[model samples]
Target: MTITATRSTELDQHRELNADETAVKSVRARIAEAGVEYVYYQIVTLTGRVVGKVVPARHLPRNIEHGIQAHPGVVADLQVDGSGAMLAGSPERGECVVLPDLDSFGVLPWDTRTGFFFCRMYEPDHAPGDDGGRPVPIDARGNLRRVHAGFTARTGLEMRSGIEPEVTWEVPGLSTEHVPGTPHTMYHLEHMERLRPVYQKVIEYGRALGLDMIEGNCEDPGQLELNWMFDHADRTADRLILHRQICRRVAREAGATVSFMPKPADDRFGNGCHHNISLWDGERNVFVDPDVPGLHLTQTGKDALGGILTHAAASTAVMGPTVNSYKRYLHTGQFAPLEINWGMDNKTCAVRMPANGRLEIKSPDSMVNPYLSHAVLLAAVEDGLTQGIDPGLPRTTGTGVPSPFGSLPLTLKDALDLFAVDQAVARGLGSELADLFLRLKTREWERFCASVTDWERRMYGAEGC
Candidate 1:
């Protein structure tokens, strides 16, 4: 399996290519067998994967370049963090393989111009391994399963989740963030007009990706949301990963860069990856008890909420994992809550009891690996349950914004450091996973840290000199 050129023919170079080709062929055959006509997939280094279905069209016939692409990395403005920082120097650009995920094949109920494979970025020669192989570290699906099984075993409760994404999309080069030529409110109609074809393409893409998605417009103009049907926590997280990719791709073909940047523009509002998660003790809601006086939430439910809040600061790394993530929590001296307080009907708190039974957190944004983020989040909830933590009556003594509850980290480095100190993170995620994450994130942070900022240079050139 070790196939360096310096190595033996036991590791044939041609064999790897053949193996990858076979894998691709096998998957393509599976899609055919499944009666699927379109397929799509995306590849990114870390993890979070889903495959989408697309309808093949005469015009968009299989792209001549049908693989994970690399063309000298010449797109000079490639921003790694999506935070507007640019990387310099041409990194070695090589072809990364993108094989379709046949397991994700499905026929589109709508338009059929494109099909998709939830693609995998694989080593060219890497064949599908033994029937079962160790998971890639970034695989949120695997990570969530590991944690989900652990939590259910201990509490006899499993979680189910659904999402309501609040997003705004426009044709490319129309960004208010980078270019501020027009009123933000007026851009939606134009966005919608251009988005029509993209919407049809999305329907085609969703089927290939195996997403049970339904799309709709939201209260905002270009504002749109896609509802991914409910699934167990582990699986739902995986779908979100794929969902993000699908939405972006369809948007791009229609000439838009789908952004999940927490706050793309300072003057405008940011988006929230609102999670509606509930625990089920074998299909029955655990938090559903209509009565008040110590009966509103089962002790188990309260424990989970308490664990999340008490450890809220520590969990900030996962919940609000990026610098931009904190931007949504504006501290403009208004009623908006940047702190960690929770209450029913209180959007003011980090954790809000939206209604009678459901608990919601607006802290997490789309940039997160939904599965990994969910796992860490669940771990926090699990910790509270185990410790029998009490959320203590939601500051219900009739309070004014429940006294600000500090805030999440302002930068990736800050979040990484906070995660390092969280004992619950270590306990829930396991040392190997936690340590590996720290090391990886630290490297990413250093990369950002060492880079020279255009802002710093422009602002300080003459003054500093």
Candidate 2:
């Protein structure tokens, strides 16, 4: 459906809101049945931040039929790419419509009167003569959908994945100072019990938000690792986004701050969102190759691992998207990987075959955008499978052996450089996305480099020669 912009002075006058009849009916039913008074129409920005406009539940009809209007360039608010410039030039562009995914309508467990819906951006005029009016090109979730479709079409297989999201939280009065949970004592039940009320609420809200909420353990001071049932790759990615939102909301209500920053502190253990993956064909677990000795992952598994390893450096730009993410990779013994290698039940390697059929990529951190990360890995795996690439030996030569695929990227800059030059990643993520991402990250790197930190000021202040 098309809606002419009421406020034309700000941007364009036309808007396109695309939704089908069935979706509209479903959304309407949910709003009434759930007694939801307000609905947040949300989208994920390039920085993985959730930003959007909220509409009254009374306007569910309008929003479902003709998506709510939002600033066209909001998704790229921080996306400074190619020309070493931010998206400021196109700031005044007209509003774009965000079509709500009816399937995503869920009542915020913490607040029953409010509901939330994830949306996809589309240009106003999808006319034949219109040049720029199309599906928002930078939509990571949309891009992942496209990539997943192509992979399924080509290989007749689907990927299943589970995410172990480790996040840290701090309470208002009790946990004033940021510190690791009792120094190096991992998974202590006492820590979990100490914060039982806070985490219990998290689990409660998580289930209400449609998450499976398998279990959670205290990883460090104020840090907890939560698990949910795994599902199809795309679905799992969606769940991760919801999972993060739930954690934050729950923490806020408890008068605490929750963070998914990969490395919130330099000395403590960084939060890692490790990806556990497997491939399937129909009802069969193709990844489980009983004929293969030892690890038992099939040839298909090897190829996928090979593709991932081949693009390990470039994928780091997505897996570990933030500047602080690099801090997690500082050492080998810290559970974060320093080298690009796959091993059997080895946490030190980039990819670890923790179970018989499931493989885990330890490179990604809590900072990753789940949609983009899953898309990148799927594309890399496809590249490997299609070309029949081998992932080399399983690094069975032991923990101290030299890295076969060399060292993983240590910083956002290094990852961006490798990502920019990698044709495979370019093809995987599409040139447009890869270029835009590089631009945004380059700007981040520039900002970081330009900033003078407290440590820098302290150390170099006295050395003014």
Report the number of the highest-lDDT candidate: 2
Specify the highest-TM-score model's number.
2
Residue-level lDDT for 249 in candidate 1: 71
Q: Candidate 2 on 1-465: residue-level lDDT in tens?
A: 998864331113222223556766776787788889999999887677888887889987667767777774566665555475556227556666677777778898777789988877666654244443466667777678778878889999998999999998887544523345435446777667778877888788888878888988876678888888988998898888888888877877887888888888866678999999988898788888667667577888889889999888889999999889998898446789988998888767889998887889998899898888988898899899988888888776544777667888889999998998888787767776777777777888988898999879777798653
lDDT of 1 at 244: 72
Model 2: which ten-residue window has the lowest total lDDT? 9-18
Q: What local distance difference test score does each model get?
A: 0.58, 0.79
Can you give the TM-score per candidate against the true fold? 0.68, 0.89
Worst 10 residues of 1 by lDDT: 70-79
The total of clashing pairs for model 2 equals: 6
